[model samples]
Target: MDALDIVMNKDKAVPYYQPIISADKQEIEGYRVSGKVKGEGEKWIDLHPFFADNSIPDDYRQEIDDHIKQVAVSKYLHENRSELLFFSLNPNLVVPENIEQFIDRLSVFKSQGLPFEKMVIELKEHQFEGDVSNLKHFVQYIQSLQVKVALDDVGTSSTQLDEIALLQPDIIKVDLHAIGNSPFPSVLTEVLHSLSSLSRKIGASLLFQNIQEFTHLNYAWRHGARYYQGSYLSKESLTFLDKKSFTQALNKDFHRFLSFEKKKIKSQIALTDTLTKRLKNYLNNNKDFSDIDQVTKEIASVLSDYSFRVYICNEEGIQQSGNALKDEKGVWQYRVEERYRNWSWRPYFLENIVRLQYEQKGMLSDLYTDIHREERIRTYSYPLNDQLYVFADIPYSYLYEKDFLL
Candidate 1:
């Protein structure tokens, strides 16, 4: 359907609601409203293309948006719905002049029993063409009305952390569709995990959308998503769904996810225990710490099955021993230049060192991409002594062989 056709036939435009389910309650928390136009026969054409088309006049798009909002809000109020209502706002259209008008429209809905607190405005920050400070002010003004603001399309498109921080939205929306079927899923997983951490620090809830499969749902759940939205749970519809429609199904899926995560954790713990035992045995046999290079080579040989590289670091994260790395022929070679390198600048280097010292146990680091190899790997850090720690770099090949490790 043409944008002009939808704009001209304003009455044909309607609202479609996609349910957003909560992780904690495993129930429908709200519905994200999208515009659809009644097409030929019984089909409804999505106006997403029309809205996304920058060529379309702002007023033409806004008219259809208004129609959908009015119809959706009316239907919601008539049904006496208690769940939240999420409405997408174009940051480009959110100007100083029309902001008050926008708030007034929401105020009208509030007066009609739909509280401001129940309304969530999702803004695509990356698409915003206006000044960031102006957008920030607009978000602040609406938020002042007890209305929640969500920064949409985070970790997708061209969104940045600075924009998110500046907006300080009540929720951060991450679309799983962007990471679909990527060969380097580990890289994307790390990015999502970083976003999750940022969300926690900023006190914003993570809402994962476009979850079209069990893996996507599991990804969302594992990444600390407070809410989920996608075809996997419920697709967009003309009418509202039961609040607890997905509760039972979600509970079952959550159980499976939990069990799988537990298995992964157990595998990690088992590996850690195995490494600790091996290290203890090696230390018992080699009492002389004078030959650091020889000690590293010996330990690397002992852990040849699990690690491709092994080295020793001091309490301050300075390399005490040269890196004993495995070659293509499975021969261990010492890289002397790797010694005396300061690893304190790396993330969690100091933190993990502290944990190793306090726990006096081997710690398995989270899977991350190695800068040198450009492949996902984990580091096993063991406290060799009060002033020394042994680090082992487990290769991706080793991790790939273990089902739970990856």
Candidate 2:
């Protein structure tokens, strides 16, 4: 027999609640409904794996989805009606005819003082198949009932911005699993920033899901995640925690995170100030730094302890000097390359150059991945003269120690 048949025969489907906490408010704002089924030896089977198996029929999958939603909402209406209830449904399982059935079940709760606005129906971004415009219609129809729509598992390689724009969900829940394992942190940060900006434009709030560590929380906060959830903060349970206890531990952790970030910012400011002054003095001492070899030697001596690389470009972005890469042994090596290759096309390259033209001081760039090195780095550009500019690349490690360097 199929798993769904077994589930229905045994009446084993049940809902588990995972709390979603507000990072800014430090309170439990809502709970995501997950599913479990009774198994041998008192073990519970997670419904995710079962739902993922393609061998299951569409009707059977919908049954399981409906069961979980019904149980979650019923329990919420009877026991707790204060916080929001997030219910996820697979797009493939969503039938146009079933909308009324789902609404009828939820209307029962509405009659019992459970507000329809508190019900957030999450649609997985990665699971949606076929025409997106159809999904948009479905989402709009659902929203017409005064229920909010949430886009789930966002901020992945498969995230479709055009579809998201068209759907314009009320909330975007970014999955943090891939972000923690991602090798390209700078690119990830940029992607998150883009998602955050789009959320604001579309009037959608950003929620970071699967946040399992302090580092994940740090990234979410920096990238504009207002709501957060994961095993790190709290695990899924059959019963909900009281609002008082939920906020107490969460508030303590939030304060600690803020304190740590404040100290890190102070240290970064001090370090950058010292390095900028030393660079200014070095450049002033050797006003006629025409020779690339001598200029690199002088700068390398000052920045050797900290990780650094240096290169020079003309006003038009043609490489005028070779690369000065700092080795692990604190030794500097200059590599020759062809001139006239332009860096003007790079992001923020021209912006920093324009700033240097006006300020005439060293300009620091926002954190980014170096195309050549494939490492997180920040470039500091200084105008050596009206026609020449020196670019110093600082590895992310020595810059902020992974403390949200924007």
Q: Give the candidate number with the greatest TM-score.
A: 1
Instruction: Kindly report which residue stretches of model 2 are placed more than 4 angstroms away from their true locations once superposed.
Output: 1-12, 39-42, 50-54, 95-113, 178-194, 283-308, 314-338, 357-360, 385-388, 395-406
- Per-residue lDDT tens digits for candidate 1, residues 251-281, read 9999998899899999999999998899899
Clashes found in each candidate (C-alpha, N, C closer than 3 A): 0, 0
In the predicted model 2, the residue pairs found to clash are none
lDDT of 2 by residue, 1-406 (tens): 3575656654777899999988666778899998888777878878887777778886677678777877787788778558889987777666454667767767876886778899898888667766777788888987988899999989874877877899999999998887665333666677888899899999999999998877787777877888989987888999887655457776777788789778867755665676678888887778886786567656766767664787778888888877778777767887766345688987667877888889887666666777877876777677878988877788866765545453
TM-score (C-alpha) between model 1 and the true structure: 0.96
| Candidate 2 lDDT score relative to the true structure | 0.78
lDDT per model, in order? 0.89, 0.78
lDDT of 2 at 255: 80
TM-score of each model, in listed order: 0.96, 0.80
